[model samples]
Target: MESSLLLIQLLNGLQLGILLFLLSAGLTLTFGIMDFVNLAHGSLYMLGAFLCASLTLYSGSFVLAVLLALPLTALAGFALEKIVVRHLYERNHLDHVLATFGLILCLDTLAHLIWGPAGIAIPLPDTLNGQVELLTGVVVPTFRLLIIGTGLLAALGLYLLVNHTRIGMLIRAGASNRTMVGALGVDISTLFSGVFALGAALAGLAGMLVAPIAEASIGMGNDIIITTFVVIIIGGIGSMKGAFLAALLIGLIDTLGRSFLDDLFKLLMSTEAAETAAPAVSAMLVYLLMAAVLAVRPQGLFPPLSR
Candidate 1:
């Protein structure tokens, strides 16, 4: 395998992992603390992309669009929690799944109505649309680098927010034992609402960042939502640290497998056989890893430490 190609693939894998981390960070919090299973989380992602796309077009500034879209996505999350999700919190996971599944359809249709059926493409300025060379013969898109940086910053911010601040203390407490936190005079309802909104914003950030690379289409979140769930599951359900590391691992595995598996397979079998099997196996790599992890450590590679 060529070294340059390998490096490029490695970077691509890192980018994918960053996106997964962005989506999963907030989700793990919501899932771990509220015990809420929100299938509609992906809808927030789609909503963010579309919102950013529209705002970018109107303002002629991609950066400004993202800034504006974040609060809107958060507000959307807050409203959903207040109007719908809060009611279902007392119900079981099955109910959460069914309700959120219905919510997916509702949000999708709403997006379709407002944005129309076609995907909206976001335009980047020349400064970001160009390419940069990390080294001789190793050039990558400038926007991709921006994505990596933005995601890492977001992750760092989340770490500080969850570990250093007072709310972080509350969040950690809530994750460990929400009932105890509630009994201690903390307003569980407010805490849950804030968490859900935060999760939505994070998911939205993922969507906004990706909109330029891939047009923001209706139901775009449907596919990614599944992968995001796999990520959180592979990481411990409520562990931020688990989610970050696991996201990167899955990202590298999926990206590298797709890029290099065919070459490896060719060495082991007939070219035609390798060509066919490579695609199938590459697609299944993430699932296979998840299965292996589940078999050995059902709690995940980095289960959250108990308080």
Candidate 2:
């Protein structure tokens, strides 16, 4: 039974990990291909949640809300790329960070103004609200399973899109040498817009999926943005494959660490010490994993070509 409980927790970790990968995959691609550091990526996620919530309330359908929000969010991304992000591309990382940080502030304020300060609760359709019994007799929420399935599908789709399409070839070329791609007469601006839009759409999809589970609120993106950054760093900047693996690893470590770290600590230390240390230690596990990875690989698990 205890082992079964552990298995359930592992599945939960995987679910969370896959969602993180969906968000991080787009983020890493935007950075890798366009060299654009967008801290406001989380804003797109927030927008998706809000849009889905509003649309679901109005349309009375989660599927329709998601469908509408995807393109809208993609447009929002394209607008940001054209209106604000384009100027920051040639600037240093610090400038990009500042500009994107400002965008975050603007977005959060706008979300608050539009959605009001209160958090919105997304209602899960009855069909997706229950629990399912797995092979080991462990019951897990159906909504979580849906999230896991959607995330995996998105990851697989992105893999094929980036590795097997002409656009994918262009993205690869841009990642390795943006200047050279432009020199070769590629319309780099169009590529940038497409990449940014795709990234935003992914973030929005993640937000919409998670909204039924987590509250949609102003400033909700802040914590998630930090988590996404950790996923990218651990996975390797600009590497979608790395992001997927690292996100899953981090998710499993975080979930399992939270579940079992206290017990493990009690075995090695006093109960008081274990209580004091467990939370902090569990929170640090992903960072520790990242540090370990960097110590060995330096650049990341899969560094994109520097030039």
Candidate 3:
């Protein structure tokens, strides 16, 4: 039974890590390649969840709602870049941070005014509402399995796009040296816009996917965005491979810590003492890990090779 419980928690950690990957993928790209500091990325995630939930509720079809949300979020991303983000690309990081921070405040307020203060719950599709027995007696939710599959697929697709394609060549060059790419006659503005849109769409997709589990709320983005940032940092900025690995590691450490830390502590201390110290220790585990990693390798586990 303990083994089964451990396996279940591991799966849970993987699911959480996968969601972080979706969010951090875009964030790392934008910050690593474009050098843009987008503090409002979390707002995009929150907005995507709310929009997807609203559409799913109205359309009465979960599949269609997800399909619809992707493009809609992409469009929203494009519009945001064209209108506001583009202006900050050439500016310093401080300016980018301030402008995007204002954006967060505005977007959150707008969400509250539009959707009210209550959270929205998305009903699970019939196809994914059941649990699957992976072994003789161990069971897992179909939705969580879907999330794992979807995240892996996205990672594979992103790998191919970044490594095998012509545009990807340009993106790589741009990441290494933006001026050289412009000198090569590539349309830098359009490329940046596309990258920004792609990032937004990824974040949105993550939000939508997790909505059924966490519910759609105005401040949902803030809750997970910090974790996403941690994933990016631990993985190394601008390194997708690092992001993927680091996310899983952080997830496992976090989930397992929260679940088992108290029990482990009780073996060494009184139950009351263990309970009192476990929560704080577990909560700080990731940050402690991050600091340890940074102290050893300041650039992170897998910083971009180009850098």
- Which has the better lDDT: candidate 1, or candidate 3? 1
lDDT of 3 by residue, 1-307 (tens): 8888899899999988888898999998898789997889999899889889999999998778989998898888999999999998889999999999899999999999999999999998889999998876679999999988988898888889989999888878889999889988999999999999999999998999899988999888887888888888899988989999999999899999999999999999999999999999999999999999999988999998988
**Model 1 — which ten-residue stretch has the worst lDDT?**
298-307
Best by lDDT: 1
Q: Write the per-residue lDDT of candidate 1 for residues 29-48, one digit (tens) a residue.
A: 88889988999999999999
Q: lDDT for each of the candidates?
A: 0.94, 0.90, 0.90
- Residue 23 lDDT (model 3): 91
- TM-scores for all candidates: the values are 0.98, 0.97, 0.98
- lDDT leaderboard ranking: 1, 3, 2
Number of residue pairs clashing in candidate 2, backbone atoms closer than 3 angstroms, sequence gap of 3 or more or interchain = 0
Off by over 4 Å in 2: 305-307
lDDT of 3 at 255: 97
Candidate 1 CA-lDDT value: 0.94
